[model samples]
Target: MAFGQGNGLQRQVISTLDNQGRDVMGLDTLAWKYPDSSIVSGSLLTVESNHFCVLKSRGAVLDVYETGQHQIITPDKPILGNIVQGFFGGNSPWQYEAIYVQRSKLLAQNKGIATSKEMAIMEYTVDYYVHVDTKDDAVKLITHMPFAGERIPMAELTAYAGPVIEQAINQIVQVTPMEQINERIHDIIELAKGHLSEFLDIYGVHLNDVKVLIMPQDARMRELISLRAFGMSELEAVRMYLALKMADMGLVSAPNAAAGTPFQIGSSTLGTFDVGATAGLPK
Candidate 1:
């Protein structure tokens, strides 16, 4: 909406304006666009510090403004003049888009699940930082990425990058043995970051850092890992496993009465063991 301000001597028409929201530090909004197409000839454009305001029309950049209030003027360049609609005298609307791009790094995190080489379900938490490096990079971002609505939020970028990270993790984890996953955490992170960086580079986003944490979700998997880590005797480990299975099947109950059957433990289907067949024990 265009509005008037100032005294009767001189009036100003602000076709569209940023509300100082983008200037605040630690905000999730990375970029914003002026929504109204009724831009006046001499409208005011406020570009905050650490930001760039770009004027684009028909997928072409007309002019770039940085960190100040710029008065709208039709580009005098021959190529741009052919694309941008002329600004008529007085308060007339012009057909051009004003986009503000913030130059700041952003952090995003996501949780996902993938199967390991041993078929154990593993939960993964990934934290990553990303940013658009320069004004040209920001322009490439706006050009390549799908911009919806008036502003771009941090969640959208995370959502776009989440699948790529997941695919990379799955590829790495699928080949890694379950017992070695803990020791290879650093390698997994580096590998996933490398894969994600290559994919995001085309869109002009830099992956600053990526951290990956993975844990087994299966109780049986945990027990096997403990046995391997602590170097427990084979007989002792077998006895302990048998005792746990007896309790799980309700053959042995805790010291409380009135219990028909104890709740089964570690009901997760991932990496489950059939005690009767695998342990050579009668059902």
Candidate 2:
């Protein structure tokens, strides 16, 4: 909290967030409002080591306090040892907005992503750790990151970054089948990491680490894999795939479909298949 004297009134120039006398936690950014748009000439500003404060007025960043405490006083000669000057104008008061941006690594997670339309309802999860990649990006992140209570939900952050993640995954899945994608999950994740790193460059965040934690969803792909595991030939696999896909497309009616006649088992005007050969064969 910063104490300032403005218009003969002493006010605490602190953030509404975490102002209830509780230890702050899980928040990425917090801000302070000047008392009635007034700032004392010489106020006590307490800044933490891992927190950076930005003072802006008229949409212009005036001074930045990276670390330590300052009296919030502009030096007389613009030379106050190592401190940056130009924050204070005169002995009266200064009006500006102060925002604090967190400088710690944050983890975000999202589960059950279907990369593209071609992908079935497969559940693949992504895990990543992110931090402010640059000072400008830090400012950018602080501006848009949701500020509710004292903390922005890590899940929300994950969702915010989901589009970039899914875009990267979709690029990889566009060329590869689910079989190969599932087999080389780690490699695909590495590709996604690279893509996400580039995609989030505008947001000023670094994808420290990203991975596909679990990849057990493609039902049809899994079925194909199971058939292969059971020593089925490639020709049989293709035939089975066609049959299943046809039924799935509704061209071949399901078991509950009405039959034309009593002896007509799966008798359709479209065509009749020799189910005898495709039935239980030599194992």
Candidate 3:
């Protein structure tokens, strides 16, 4: 707690020291807000290392303070100082919100579904790292991202970035052939990292790293892709795949010849196979 003397009234001192304990405990706390908005002139604003303070009012970011102690009405910070001086007496308190934003890196793992160039549906998971790297970034985060509680947690940051990461993955997969996706996984991750970095720039966040893992959702597609990844030609891979027939228990779905049913083999559809009527197979 900090205090100041102005106009025979006590001005409040504010800092994130009260909440720093939670931050140090790996809570992933992103930003903490001072509970009261009635800020007084000449009050001390303490900004700790690896964090910055965003001064805002009426939903607008008025000023940003870096790692240092700032007198609320200092001459160097005209935007906030002027705003405070305009309405209240030189030494009176005014309404302003102070948001302290942390600079710690955040890691998030997100999964999404997308279709490849061959129209094979794929499911992918991306692990990414990001952080607010500058005062401008801190301002951008506070201005662009929504905050409802006393603080913003890392989970919310991940939630905001999940769709962006998935969108980047979709863009990459939509143009990559299924047969080549496995071989180009490293290239895909690099492209996704670049795309996510560029996408987060507008929000003042810097992406540090990204890892993506993609595989087709269809069982047959997964098998085919896995087989093809072993330097096998498409025909060789398909020929190597065995369609097992079960007698008691196996992966067999023999179509009923009486009903003339059709079944899928690999990527092809085959007509019904006729078995003798006395075969005694389940219909």
TM-score sort, best first? 1, 3, 2
Model 1 TM: 0.67
Q: Write down the TM-score of every candidate.
A: 0.67, 0.57, 0.64
Candidate 2 has its poorest 10 consecutive residues by lDDT at 254-263
The residue-by-residue lDDT of candidate 3 on 1-283, one tens digit each, is: 3222222223556676543343331447777787767675667887777788998876777789998888886332443445546655544343578888888787767787888898988888888777889888998877777775877777777787777777777776889887677777887788778877877787787888777888889887787667677876765555334322222334345323323344556986654433432222333
Candidate 3 clash pair list = 2-13
lDDT of 1 by residue, 1-283 (tens): 3223431212233322424422432467667776554444456777666677778876788877776787876533332322333443423233567777767677878788989998989989998888777778778778877776887777777788888888988887988888788788877888889988988787777888788889888777677567657775644454456556556767432211112122244772222223233332222
User: For model 3, where is the 10-residue window of minimal lDDT?
Assistant: 1-10
User: Which stretches of candidate 1 lie above 4 Å from their native place?
Assistant: 1-26, 75-93, 219-283
Error at 34, model 1, angstroms: 2.0
Query: Which one is best on TM-score?
Result: 1
